[model samples]
Target chain A: MEIKTRQFKAVARQELNNPNSRIFLDLLPVVLSSLRQLAMASFPDPEAAQRLGGIIRAEALSRLPELLEQFEKNALKAGAKVFWAGDAHAANAYILELARNNQVDFVTKGKSMVTEEMGINEVLEKNGIEVYETDLGEFIAQLLKRPPFHIVGPAANVPPPEIRDIFIEKGIMENPTVDPRELGYAARLYLRDRFSRMKMGITGINFAVAETGTIINVENEGNIRFNKSSPKIQVSVMTLEKVIPNLKDAMHMLRLVSRNCTGQHIGAYASMDTGPRKKDEMDGPDELHIIILDNGRTRLYQNVKTRQALQCIRCGGCLNICPVFGIIGGFPYGWVYSGPMGQLLTPLLLGLSGCHDHIWACTGCGACKANCPAGIDHPRVLHYLREMEVQGEKSLDAVPPPFTEDMAYKAFSVIASNPTLWKLTSKIIRTVLNRNAQDGKLSKGPGPLETWLAGRDFPQMGDKTFHERWKEIENNPPKAVLEN
Target chain B: MKTVSLFVPCIVDLFLPDIGEAMARLLKRLGLSLVYHDAQTCCGQPAFHGGRNPEAVKLAKRFIEIFENDETIVCPSGSCVVMVKKHYPELLADDPAWLKRAQAVAERIFELSEFIVDIMGIADVGASFSGKVAYHESCQLSRELGVVEQPKTLIRAVNGTELVPLNGAAVCCGFGGHFSVTYADISEALVKEKAVHYIASKADLLVISEPGCFLNINGYLSRNHPEHKAMHIAEFLAGKQN
Candidate 1:
């Protein structure tokens, strides 16, 4: 992903106005939210499930350094080669070199956001290696040369006709078809050959248990299963914060992720690999390579307030319930992550320079916080980010807002503090506004009020302040006022 | 008799003083002695939520000083009540004594319907309105203040009123103080979506508890769908009773 997050206004305007995108984004969150609620009924204690999910992630992040070391030692002991990459550049380079060492010119990849974050597909293609995205959404997205629309269901909401055309253009379909099952079959057939011949399989680790040297990948389609075992070598790329304290916590997180994501009790397949196959095992990879990348995660871990960002399990629940995401979709986020999590991560990881747009885009409705199974306080973090941005602590690339916006807030603060000042200011503004009022409403507004009045009528200000009206009658002021 | 201090929000004081007057009339009818502090101004919510905490602190402290001695504080807008209850303590966290005072003041502050139903134990205030009425769940009231049922309970208590459930009623109306103008496109889309849902409900009038939503939703309705009517819950109940 190129960092066009700075162009959020233009991108969001386009997405908001596009009928196709609007229809899909509007319908997705409502459907996802309802499914999640219905699935939540199956839990003996759903609230406890939510709490435990958050606690486990918090525990993992608090002891991340120790847990990562423990996970590395145990994974190595279990016969997996573990490599640590400090950032996306190193992670991409390490994976490219590993492919060269394994004598592979092509690799099969499952649904891995880490790879996307690392820009691994572009890196491999540039270096003369064929990379095939096997997740049905990623596959279609790859064919279309577009980014995923939603985190869980990347190509899920894409129009069937467009996908049908893409499939026909790629020679996957003999004829154009809009049926999803037919399209799935076409993609499966096209991808099966690549799966068999690809010597290296790349995957994303959903959770790495520190108690045992185990890495788990949860998915509905079995692309991850084949991506891990159908090849001579497997490379799993994960961020360092994905580790959990134990297998018990990992199981709890799995249940939460499944229900919150697709409203399923469990994903169809959960591949938990301790390491490469032992001598007795059959149909497994000969070598297991786990790449744990810490791309700007440690900076978050060091900050007390922002460390909460690391607790995200990538369930995409926040995106499914977010009103903004429901309106404009994912591409406007301008990065691998989207929605509340995207708002937090983009500014933190990509730096505020190119990504403050989405961060500022949040309405602070707290819907994401309520929907998050991890109980991540996204609105609070967003407010903090906005405050930081306003303070100019980050993003030297960000241009300052017009003086009117800043001065308005500053002037409001002064007027809000003193009743005398507020009364005088309100009187002057109201008198002016009322003078211009037409038929009990200000049909046309001046300055910034134009934006508000453009869509809605501004009601005429009242003739008298509440205080003035209250004082007209002979009444005693509050006892509290006299006491003060 | 209950003694109450009325916290008149800046908007209510300026554009919609009738809401505050209606709230006062309702409180009086309930045998509550309401005191209006002439010195009371804004709740600092506009500045506080705008990321101007230092400036908000002056108003917040002034607010605490004005209402600290009252038995209870009632505000017509849930948006202001949320600012007082949730953010005041945070703004004053650096000063231990002020934080304690803010926490205390927060405890006694309530939105009108919450004070009426939860504190006064009066769901029915002897009001009547014969029509389909839909309630817009103001984000600060419903989500931030957790006063979801209080407003609906009061609305339903009005005789001859048929409460209609609105789709996406709990979603924001995009009156997020400065957000309406700052992010005009997104804010416009949200309010328009809210209006569409309200229109779909086929309600005769839309009722709301927070002034911000009352203004924002009604503003859109007046411009785009003038056939629709929206009013503050205080005005609705007070008008019927008086």
Candidate 2:
């Protein structure tokens, strides 16, 4: 995928102006969040259930190496081929080679963000191998050549009229209809043909259970099940963090992810593949290959602060509650991941320098943190990322913040730490800010305040600041007291 | 009478000192002795949010040194209290002495409503507003500090002030310190929606606990819908009218 993370502000502004995007953005969070609230009510203790999900993710990430090894060993024992790819290039190359060796003209894919991260479809297409996105939303997103608007619904924000136009253009539908069901049936029929004829299928592993050496994929549309069952050769790609200690943990995560993602008790299909089809089996893949991709995750795990990001189960819960994501949708994130997840992951995967806008475009609202099922402290992580960006990190390819900002903060620190300097500076700042004031309000201003003043009015700095008035207020009873 | 040290945040100190005065007035009426630490400047929120950790550390130490000895501390801004109570310890983690002080100060500090309703066990502060009012839950105060019910309790206690429902009241008003300016467009969108909700609630006044939120929401209301008013909880509870 093209990296447009640097265009965050431009894209975000564009999204904000888009009325079509606004309708979806407003409805998505409210609907999904309320549904999530209802679904979570099923738990005896929702908070504890959420906390346990966090614990599971933390444990899995902390014991990541051991869990990955155990998963590989068990997967190999179960007659599945396991390949470890250090990066996206390696992962894509392995998948491309596998497709070529199988003599397959095309491969059907079950919605996999990791595959998008690896740019697998682009690679396969460039190599003349057709790749069909079996997931209905993903199929629309792919045909439209756009990034996923939301994690759960790639084309969810894309309006029906737009989908109808794209479906017609892609020859998926003969009749032009804005109805979602009709569009969906057209996609199903189109994808179904590919599913039946495809020799190879690729999917993303939701949970790679080390206890049973089974790879699990959960989906509502049954496309992932078909991807697992119809093909002779099946390839499942997983990030190392996907490996859990046991099936019980996987079940626990399934409960969390389902409720958090789409507010479902459970996805329609929870297909698990231990390995290839047995000799006695009538159907299922003849070859089962699992590729474990690192792709900057190992480096992310090296730092204690960054490692917490790996705990995310990609439930899109954060997106549903994030005010920033609610306003701008997903395109501004300019990568495979969007919302708080994108803010946390993109900076780590893509260098901080390139992802400057992506990281800083948050309100530091803890809604994402409070809502995350995986227990990722997004605001804290974002703060850490901001620190790294300001200070610069060699390993992460981060450059130090601009000289002006650096100096501004330095001056701010000096003034803020000393009361006398603070008072003096406050007076100077007040006079300058109030220069254009009318009726004790500055309707517009220059510099950083320009943007704020564009849409809102700022109060003129108080004539008598709190510090200056304390002496008088202390000696006299409060007005409320005097009134009584 | 319990003595409460006032940690007036920089925003309240400069932009909205009325909030600080209101807080002082409300506390004084409740029979709490208020001590204003004039030497205190900031809680290092701007520096911390700007990723200037060293500068934030300096300000944090300054804050700790000034208020560490107080029996109890209260502030009008939840985000500032969060800065001292939550981020300060993490920022000072490398320095044991400062971290210890930060942790101690963290416990002693409380947001105004939290201090009044929770610690002081006084919900009715002898305040009243004869109109329907909706409370805007600031992000850090509500979620980070979990100080939701305390402010609402105080609002409900006010004579004739109906605590009306505010749709998406807990959603951010988008004054994320520097975020309002840097990502101004997105911030504007959010604050606009907040104003929309506030207007739709038909509440005579919208009350907020945090001054940052007050500046943002009131700033928008001032420009776009000058008639629609929002007040800090301090001012509202202090019986000050907009």
Candidate 3:
């Protein structure tokens, strides 16, 4: 509201005061349990739920190596070549190498956060190649020269009229009032040209089934289908985490990840491309490469607490449901993933110094935790991050240890151990607070009391302590007081 | 007839003392004994929301220390009642004495609606209210604690009141604890949406169990839609009796 406003504190305090916050907080357990039920169940049956949950937990960490070997097997069978990229840089180079190997300068790209993560466009464009973003939102964002603000609805912060304005500025649409459909058609026309002529198509895999070496691309606009089917050389750069054991689970994953991310039952395009189209196949790429990029994930998965991040289907439910992410927007995560999943994932992958604040800003309300299909306990991870933060701060020698506690924690530990001491302390604290009440109301809440008042009104901390009243009633019982 | 211990949440005690009285009177009518633990400053709802988690435990420990006897601790506010029923055990785990107290208390800590519906085992409490009333589902009560059905069930069980659904009926009414004040703009947006739903629902009386929801809906009704009437669930029930 003001320039000097402590936005984070203000936002946090405001969230704390919200009635919905309480409702949501209380509602969380039920929501969590029910969603857990949803995630566990493939058929919404008891056995399927347990079975699916068990499979995920058992082999979630070892997904990468299994995926590479599976890809080798499946791709070799399908007469396709596979490349391995140790990191994002190598992955970008490998994709660029594919483009160069094809003698290609123009490429059509689909919406891929992983591509953004790898800085594919920058690397390719700097090497004097043309990249066309085929997804409508991605196209607008590319035109605006900005990374996507949202994963699913990439420009949530950009109003429709503003987007119309952007479209007109780019001359993609002649009128400023370009309805979303017309603007989409414009991109379709432009991308159709790119699709027909482009030598190579680049995309990201939502999931790669190890059983078939099948790469699944989930898209609303069918650009992923075009990317997979049209290009002479198709390279889908994927993080190793996308690999699953088989196709049945891959279909089940599509069923959940789509609904969870888009609030729709299914995306329009859920095409599974296994290597370039075979000679027997009716349509698709001649040269197919599934670049399995490790990119520091192997090390991240080495630890248990951080590894569930690998389970992120990139559903973006964590962003949409997040109260903070809803307001501040997602570009601030400063990377491919944002919101609850990104915070945990990016820190482990990119290093904490860059994305530690992602963990710090979380309210730990567990909306992300509850909604996560993978049953990733985001808040628990956030709690882990918080403790790690305190430890890291100590390690950094930022704030001297003496100042972190205000005689309060020390006093609490001591009193908690001795009941007599705690009782004495509560009695004294109540007395001092009650004394401040002028008209049965303590208008000015003191010290730590101020944080409480940031969004609430506190009456003088009860004039008569509960203990005193309880004692009095017990000694000389009034009928109602005694009955209570 | 079941004997229920009444936990009058701190907010009800101070701001809406009458609700506390109504809850007591309502329970008495049901042949239940009301035991007011006067020493109860709070269920540590404030401390928990403030993230003074240990202090919240401190407050809870003191509560268990003072009221270590056997009785069902039923609080009127879902906010505090949930804290007692659920979080209390997590807080007192290290101390067995306190843990036992927490476990015993949690088993009995019921929100007023829950106590009336489940323990009292009556959907309709022979209560009737006049006017078109749409109930706001407090997040904690509905989502966190899973009491969404109880209040609606009771409202339906009541004869006179027409139960109407608000738009995004399950959406937060911007009473995200401290959210109403801190992110006033967005909070105000959420409030306005709820108010618009109320207008569309054409409910003359808006009933909510939560004090925080009561305040936000009141503010929205005052500043924007001044014509709509709102009353807490306790106030509504009390008014019916009156």
Candidate 4:
């Protein structure tokens, strides 16, 4: 996806500051932190955690291929048709064709990050099918026509009064009130009618089981259940990497996923099945379709340092702890996922153009890496990505324009290789910049460093380097040592 | 006793020469033979991090030439020591000779606190300071280098210097090598958050190993909030001023 830099950030910034996000995040931190504390408190012993973590990793990795196959089988078994998309354009075309096939005049979708990346809504809407976002947070974002600032908490930055204002304008709510529960209930009621009647329901998968070819959806709101169960034709869309080997793996992932995301032992519902509803079941769609998208996961899987990004359960721990992510917020990430995962995924999924603007944003602090259950060395991966950017290597997107940075790096190689030049630079620094007298401090400077001296008092440079100062003291000293 | 080589980081070589002298005196007092390699300039941190690979490799090879025979290499800066241990191998991947040398360099490199604890086997340096001192754990040193408790252990040796734990001890202070300028807005916010924690702790001095964090948090607090002051660990210990 070729994204214009400032335009993309503007959409993100607007979404973050939007009322829904403020309300959501303000309320979310208290809930999230409390839940995290509870989760940590209830955590199994270290030995048990290690065992569970191992199983989870094995479950996800082993089931990847078989899950793809099973999902294909179940999707085909359902009365609804399925399509294979190797890339973004293919997925968009496939969804477009599916809309045309269903004769879908209007489609209602729960927030699917996968679809957002594929530009599915835009594609379907451009083809004259009206797309309505049914998720509460999503509905708010759509009212203003912007991308979500967060993956799970689309409305994290939005506060209640502004949301009430937006709702008042959109004619969803009667007036502003201080109650969030009532607000959530209002959104639930408003979205229910569309959920019941939409011809097709679109949803993203939390996990796809390879054993039974089942797609599992985790939700607290019951909207997902409605999206999956109520529509005549339900289309489950997921990135190919979502596949897991079996039921056991799916359960293990669920343990971490539920706890990490919302601080539950499990989400309220873990709706699971390989195909359409069972013969005995009265509820659930008659036809169930699943579309698995590659979107560059295969390429990413081949790299060692980065492949662990797939192991993300979409838990946002890294974001909460990340100083950059916490302070700057998510919009600057320029894509669906944010924080550590985005730094890894954006480059691999959308390519370098979107990634470079961010890949450097990381401080190599390893907060994300430490907190990550998958043990992804996020800072290391970020550093490697930056290296890839500098080398003009095109894993994705355009190699930076030759005029952009090649000359600077070329000059660096020449300057670094020569001892004399290196010595000269150091000499100039010591003579001009380091010439000083007070308790080892630089009193003044010129050129680029003039600004540095403007506010903060400068530290003095030593007349001779430590090694030189030491060598002179021991070798031939009537010399007054630079006293400590 | 084992012989040790000193790799005073390039910045210390130029700016904080007293820290180097203090370290040398402290080591000499401890009775270990010291080899100071003059040929050493940098651990190739700036060049390697900047993606000038060949230059970094050339410097690494030069480093190996200068200090290949030393039994152990110690540096006061956790950040540079980590860079040398981690990034050096990537720099010399195509060359087997340098790869072996790179691994050898990594195997022996130690941060000052770790060298004191592991090599010297001394929990506290018989030093003294008065008033409250909050230790700032630089991320690379504490996390990557796993030297979290070393500074605390050393601080306990000093009489009258009470160690106060800084809030959000594990969070970065936004001194991520080019991160300070690249994401200045976030960096400023992070530093301010840290300053609040410092002020709340009501400590007389903030002690740190990594210069980046020292300058960043110190710079922010000194300018905007004058009630607090920051000092690097070396300066704090060597200055002997509470």
Estimate every model's Cα lDDT from 0 to 1: 0.85, 0.90, 0.67, 0.71
User: Compared with the true structure, what per-residue lDDT tens digits does model 2 show for residues A251-273?
Assistant: 99999999999899888899888
Better of 2 and 4 by DockQ: 2
Question: Candidate order by DockQ, highest to lowest?
Answer: 2, 1, 4, 3
Better of 3 and 4 by TM-score: 4
Strongest candidate by lDDT = 2
> For residues A217-282, could you state the per-residue lDDT of candidate 1 as single tens digits?
999999999999888999999999999989999999999999999999899999999999999998
Q: Model 4, which residues run further than 4 Å from truth?
A: A1-38, A46-67, A74-81, A302-306, A401-424, A432-460, A472-484
Instruction: For candidate 2, write residues B18-120 as lDDT tens digits.
Output: 8898889888988888888889988889988888889988888888899989999999999999999999999989889888989999999999999888898
Deviation from native of the Cα of residue A56 in model 1, angstroms: 1.7
DockQ of each: 0.49, 0.74, 0.12, 0.47
The share of true interface contacts that also appear in candidate 3 amounts to: 0.01
Report lDDT (Cα) of residue A78, candidate 1. 97
RMSD for each of the candidates: 3.4, 1.3, 6.7, 3.9
What ordering of candidates by TM-score runs from best to worst?
Answer: 2, 1, 4, 3
lDDT of 3 at B100: 86
Per-model B-chain TM-score: 0.97, 0.98, 0.91, 0.91
TM-score for each candidate, following the candidate numbering = 0.96, 0.98, 0.77, 0.89
Give RMSD (Å) of candidate 3 vs. truth: 6.7
Candidate 1 lDDT tens digits, B43-105:
887776666667788889989999999889999988788889988998898899999999999
